[model samples]
Target: MDLINGFITIFSSPITMLFIVMGSVLGVVVGAVPGLTASAAIAMLVPITYYIDPLSALAFLYVIGKAGRFGGSISAILFNTPGTTAAAATILDGHPMTQKGQAGKALKTASISSAIGDFTGEILLICGALTIATFTKQLGPPEYFAIYVCAFLIIGSVISSSVLKGIVSTLFGASLAMIGLDPITSEPRFTFGTIELYNGLSLVPLLIGLFVISEVFTQASHDHSKDGRHDTIKAKNPDDDHLSMAEVKRCLPFIGKGSAIGSVVGLLPGVGSAVACFVAYGEGRRKAKNGDKWGTGVIEGIAAPESANNAVSGPSMIPLLALGVPGSTIAAMLLGVFMIHGIQVGPQIFETSGDIVYGLFAAGLIGIVLYFLIGWFGSAFIGRQIDKVPPIMIYPSILAVACVSAYTARSSLFDVGLACLFGVIGYLMRVTNLSTAAAVIAFVLAPGAEQALRQSLLLSDNGFAIFMDRPVALAFFAIPVFAISLRIYSRMRSEKTPAEMLDTA
Candidate 1:
């Protein structure tokens, strides 16, 4: 079968296997460092793969994705900082568990949950890709445009803690994404005639500045909570770790629920890991008989987030592989890396790169085994020791990686400087509660929307009614209507609360 052939190609060459191993290790390191994420890790490594076989190149990135999913938990448990937003929920109970000296239990539950969730996602991805390929063969740009509108509405409404802020963020992102090239004429519309404005702002450097560098600046301005932790984190040893089986059993149910939540949520483009975790935790507690005691360092509290966040890593790849639509902000960055490497995604990818495609799938399966080998066999020694790394030392190393990634993603030193500048802006955005997720989502969907809008208009002889000509487009328009209705209803209901009336007055 094609799958077997793909795995053979990946493993037949010892070089490919070596890269997988190296990438997994490096991914963990990147994920461990606060501010650095899996997407940045893959981008930093992508250029290194240009000369290698495509299968090997993909294999390396696959490992990074797998390990990066788990790596974020390392920081979330050790410190309150989550390396990825997916791990944000992990800090809710993980850091508290660590403070309680139940660090081993928390880490163990997290590791197992992550592994199971990731494995489940891989299964769904393989199945979904095959089905999607068969069903979507006839999809046109108009269909894609409708999907983009749907995505904007869903992500804007669901991802934001505040729907109003979320809606605003989505609009802001769209406006910025429209800054450079005109989709129809390829003429510059918003560029003010400056060379710097011609290309619009680059996303990778902007992401680096906003997510990684800005956090460093923000942290610099604050007086951190002091536990007098060590400056540098050493690599964890696989030996000398310990855990009780009773605790492991207690976490199993949570892991199962988390994985289930991840598999379902990840199928959507905008949900991402953070949403998965919060949803999983809420659902798990809702389903638990001992729900009242859920937050007091229970295994369920730890396992739910650990499973959901990691599970997303595999399923999030579904859109990227099937439609070239990225499911998460990090996946968007990886899409750039794939483009840079001359790897074209979409239905044809399976036909053209069966070996590479299959290899990536097989790698996810094998990575589970590798994760267990590292996390289970080595946690006691690695977990306790890794917990001591302070933010000051860890953050700078993240900036270094981001700088390298910005340069690598674009092959421009200007990207590095731009990333730093964006870092400052990102920091300010965080302080003001502006949504970076909104911006990233906007960047990814903007080009497609513009292309579709123009194409549809041309086909319709420049009539604005083109959007309602198709059932799909009509449904897409319903999104804004639905979102607005929900916002209004929620607002009207909220008006009766004493706190709301006080704020309004």
Candidate 2:
């Protein structure tokens, strides 16, 4: 088959194999360090790809993104610090497992789950993108707006312990998104005279400030002893170091379900691994036999989020390959790479760039294997190294990297100042139990949602009825209404006392 031939072609090249391995290793190191992201790495590498073969460039960056996501779990499990936003939910139970001296088992669970989930999503991308693209191409702005609204409501409702706080946090993000030039008019709405503000806040600064810098502040407040012995927590027993067959069997179902959720979420533009991981975690908890123990250092907790996050990597490329639309920031960078190579995307790409596409797919398959082996064999040593480093020394270095990374995104000192500002705000949010995760995701989705809604209104003379006129849009609008009502009803029922329940029964 052509697919088999593609695999052979990629495997025959020694340089391609070397790049895959090197990229995977570099990605793992970068992801394990806080404040550095896969997108940033790819952004930095764009110029380097100019001299390399197109297939090699694409393969190297693609593998880096995939491996980086998995690498995030290493720090999340061992240090209670998630290097990436997607690994946030992993901290719920991952750190607990470390405290229980089962760091090795947690690492293996993350590795195996991530590999299986990535494989499933890659398969879906290969088989289903063409079919999905045909349908997605038909969707108008109204339908897209409806989808964004649903995501906003659903994510806000599920992410926080308090629904009001969650919704408020999301709205705050949306409001900040309105600070730049209007998407429709190109008129500055909230620029306040600064040229840098004209483009609005960069995502890189906001991300580093919110996740990485805020975490540093949080860790500083903790009363961790200076004793090096507490730096690294080790497995308490031989049994704690290995993942058993029973544990793997118990986790298989959750891994499969997480993969499915991630694949579906990935196909939608602007929805990334951060949302997919939490969504998968919520679903896994709902179906778990020991749901009450979900946040108490369980294997399923690590499995669900890790699998779902990595799964998003593959399917997130679907829009790019089939529709010429980049779904995430990484995909957008890859788009630039494709353009540089003069390989057109979309439906016609199959005919014009068949060899490159197939080779890219083959590289993804191999990259998964390489990263899995690396994670499995290298995790213990990595954990020990982290443990050996003192917090005082490590955090200052991380702070420097955070500032530098934020500046490198745009070569602007103003952006560095903006990052520090957000760092303070993020620290306050963390202390207040506000959902920074919801806020960040909402910020990412806000511009697209606003554009879609505005475009739809312009296309119709009947105002909001344009949504009602479209059955798909109508259904999407109805989903949030139904979900909110159910949540309210459940809360009402749960508020009743035990005596009231008994009397009603």
Candidate 3:
């Protein structure tokens, strides 16, 4: 079978297997460290992909993201601090369980739930991408442009605390995207007579500057002079350290619901694990019989958020693979990897790059097993080790590596300087509540969107009427309208809550 052959192809490469294992371990370590995320790690390492084949490069980053999602729960349960925002909800009940000396039980619940959720989402990705790609292949420039607009509006509306800030960040990225050759006429617009500016900006440096170097700057600003100590509570009884079959049965419903919720969220552009985990936690608590006692060290609380967060790792690739749209920040980084390898994404990828696609799918499957093994068997010890490392030591090394990686992309000192500049901008954005993820996605999507819009206009003398002629384009354009209406209605409901309570009184 083609499926069997595809997996076999991946297995034949020893380098790919080696990187998968290395990535899993590295992801776990990085994710266990507070303030470090899988996105930042991948951003720091994207330049290294230049030395490897596409299959190995893609596999390494893909596994890192998958493993990193599960890794965050370790610290959340042990230290009462979430390494990633996706794990923030886990601390609600996870730390309480640790306080109760049921740390192992809570950890097992998180690990198994995460693995099942991730597997479920990956299955959906494989089936959904191929199916959607079949239809997406038939779409023209008008429909593609409409879809891009819909993505932009919906993503900006949902990702940020303030919709205005999100839209502004997205537009800012689009403006930066205009600094090179014009998409339609090939005229240089903002090159400033510099050869380096001719290509606009390289993605590797931008990613390093924004996600990796910015994080270093943020970390450096924190006080790391105090000695760190481990005060992890240990389980006294065997029952406290192991999850029984009865407990697994109790968690199955929550796991299933959470996985489904995460898969759906992942399919939408700009939605991330942080949102999915919280949503799943809320839904799980509402449906449970023990809902009233939900936050009192309940296993279901840990299961719901952990599962949903990891489930987001897989289906987030659906938009990128099927429509060449990056749905999340990690997916945006992966888009850069795809472009670097000279592989065009979208429906044509299956036909022209089938081997690479199948290899990536195989790697995803293997990574799930590898990370699950690590989480299930080694997470407790890993957490203990992470708590011992001083923040003062870890960040300086990271800063040095980030600078070196930025320069390696083109051997240009200018790129290093540019990365530092963006690092400052990124820190400011973080403090200002602006969505850097929105900016990154917009940067990747804007060029394609502009080209499609221009091509559509050239095809029709009637201007915007071309979108009306295509049913698909019209439907795509309508999505943002519905999204905006729902957002406004939600805000209105929230604003009216106090008045309604006063009236009742």
Q: Global lDDT of each model?
A: 0.72, 0.79, 0.88
Mind sharing the TM-score for model 3? 0.96
Compose the digit string of candidate 1's lDDT tens values, residues 111-187. Answer: 78888888888888888886786655566666667877777777777666667777677787788778777867778
The positional error of residue 397 in candidate 1, measured at the CA in angstroms, is 4.0
Q: Where in model 1 is the C-alpha error above 4 Å? A: 34-36, 39-58, 78-83, 91-102, 179-183, 196-201, 225-227, 230-252, 409-411, 479-505
List the candidates' TM-scores in order.
Answer: 0.84, 0.71, 0.96
Best by lDDT: 3
Tens digit per residue, CA lDDT, model 3, 1-505: 5456668977898998999999888888788888999999999889999899998999999999998898899989998889898898899889999999999998889999999999999989888888899999999999999999998988888888888998998997777788888876789988999988987888877888889888988888877766467587778888999999999999999999999999999888888999899889888987889877777799999999898998998899999999998889999998999999999999888889988888888888888889888988898989988887877888899988999999998888889988888889888898898888888889889999999999999999899898889999999899989988898888877765422432332
- Candidate 2 yields a Cα-based lDDT of 0.79
Per-residue CA lDDT of candidate 2, range 1-505, in tens?
6567668878898888888888898777667765456754654455566668888999999999999888888888887878677788888888899899898899999999999999998888877766665676678889878877876776567556667787888898788888889987899978889888888766667766776677778777876674343356767799888999999999999999999988888866556788788888888988889878887899999999899999998888986787665656677667767866888766567667878888888888989998999888897676567556666666777677778777775678988898788888888998998876677767766887898899999999999999888999889788777877886888877986423432342
**Candidate 3: minimum summed lDDT over ten consecutive residues — where?**
496-505
- Model 3 residue runs over 4 Å out of place are 225-227, 495-505
- TM-score of model 1 (CA atoms): 0.84
The regions of model 2 sitting more than 4 angstroms off are: 1-23, 26-69, 72-110, 230-364, 495-505
